[model samples]
Target: MSSSAAPAAPSAIPSEVFEPPVLAEVVRSGFVEGHHRGSLVVLAADGSVELALGDPAAPVFPRSANKPMQAAAVLRAGLDLAGERLALAAASHSGEAFHLELVHTMLAEHGLTADDLRTPPDLPLDPAEAEAYLAAGRVRERITMNCSGKHAAMLAACALNGWDRAGYLDPAHPLQQLVHQVVEEAAGETVTAVGTDGCGAPLMAISLVGLARAFRGFVLAEPGTAERRVADAMRAHPAYVAGTRRPDTWLMRELPGTLSKMGAEAVQAVALADGRALAFKVDDGATRALGPVLARTLRLLGIDAPVVDRIGHAPLLGGAGEVGEIRATF
Candidate 1:
């Protein structure tokens, strides 16, 4: 059966709740005007819904949140890396100097070069790193792409599995086939659709519930498998996965068994040890709203602690430095 056709939404958690003004505002106003609608799906490890909001059955592109599943394909195909490296491969990084260096090192290990990467070049996400690169007059290359680690892992899988490296990014390639399978299995449902992502890789469309379930599976993975390895790597080297300043990395590091990934256009996914998976997409793609929503979700999950401390309780600020809190209603 096609993975996309599988039924995966848990029939629990009320669709609507009375929303207070503050919470309602956050959920309604969003980061961009008229595009703030979002869905949150939380699933226990046993596939029970702990909470849900908006259209739980709504189909959305997971974007880079699908990286770990893709990495699972690479691992299942015999690509090997240390836990730290594996975690980095599944990250949507900040393209910092160290992050780029690691990608280069992975390429070298596979006897490849930056020239082999097909991902478009971009300035580092870190302001300091971007300034440094500009000051040094260094031209950004494919190696500096935030998704380079993922691409490098894809190439390594191709090399290890004896698949064609040149077309590894193609959706029909053997590596991508493996990725599709892994995604299907992790999601516990078939992919609804496939589309080209910002980084030029295939993106999977799945329900918010499906995405949350998949992440829950990742966190609860048994030891010695690629899934567990990816999770371990992400927690151990959170800074390298994104940056110390990045919310995704910081949140993951602060929460002992929490695994989180940030995708393009303000998509964030988090999986907790208690078998709960949370996914949220900021409608307008306003990246600023992501942190507060994520923090709010974490709080709802009873994860307050150093995690909150590391994430900090600062209110979201508008462009004028005024407090711009999310007023989620229901």
Candidate 2:
């Protein structure tokens, strides 16, 4: 995609606007006060700010929001997988049984094993799946970890480049170096800092605007490019992008020509084929807060498709039955 002009600075929010705030129900138990406390930036195809909220210039840790850029580095390094496989590599998945199976398949295809993955082990995100595993007397392995696909991709990159397979996740490793460069280029800014992610890999820090710009570029990327492949894979196989009944999967599957990805905490980013990018962060890092806010943001941007209605307006159930609904007031 062609680069757009730099976005203008965001407007300041008056204190009174936050005082008696217009509380929006972000989740069943949480409400986000009106006026974004972190930052939000919406850019047009030409890179001009169509909408700016909070500190668009503020540097924030995009976390897994940067995964596609990192995957781009793996692609540039000559890793061969594409399509659905590429999408799985960029996902923050729910560790469903099928997701775990694919991770193992990717590892085995490259003659690697779960023992090679450096990410910590965790129980499956689906409660039913976890119970099934326990009932079957299965032990959790790195293959079952949510980040297994990413690690598997790193291993594949190592195999392709003839690099050391062990310690591929090291920040100083060649794979990581390429990842850093790709992220910087995609975001159109240097990473200001680095930190370890919860999944035991390097995390990048870039401004929200930069993050938004990177996603916009991904959607507009040339066909067959790694970036484009990532977008296509995620969109084509939304189930693998997340898991069965996951919001990320539902949103992407429901909306055509839209790409959505979520990061740890409340970081959510979306890019449209029309050259628009939206990025938002909830100040409290409440995971549940993201769905409602994202629905509202898309609505404000005029994306009122049927899928948006289904995913964004999921009913809030009480003890008896349906109580209040999580509504987003534009």
Query: What is the TM-score of each predicted model, taking all chains together?
Result: 0.85, 0.86
Residue 180's lDDT within candidate 1 is 88
lDDT of 1 by residue, 1-330 (tens): 655677888879888884312222432224623225566777766778877776767678888889988888888888888666787788778877678888888999998888888888888877777888889998877777788898998988787777888888799998888888888888888888999998888888887788888888888889887788887788788877788678878777767887888888767888887778888776667666576667777777777676664453435556756444553344
Clashes of each: 16, 1
Which lDDT tens digits does candidate 2 get at residues 1-330? 999999998999676653212224534445432232355678887877887776666777787787888778888889887766888888777778778888889989989988889888877766777788778898877777777788889889999899988878778989999888888888899899988887787888888888898989889999998788888888888787778867788878877777888888678889987878898776667565577768777887888777676666645666977655655444
Question: Candidate 1 regions off by >4 Å?
Answer: 1-35, 309-323, 326-330
Candidate 2: global Cα-lDDT? 0.78
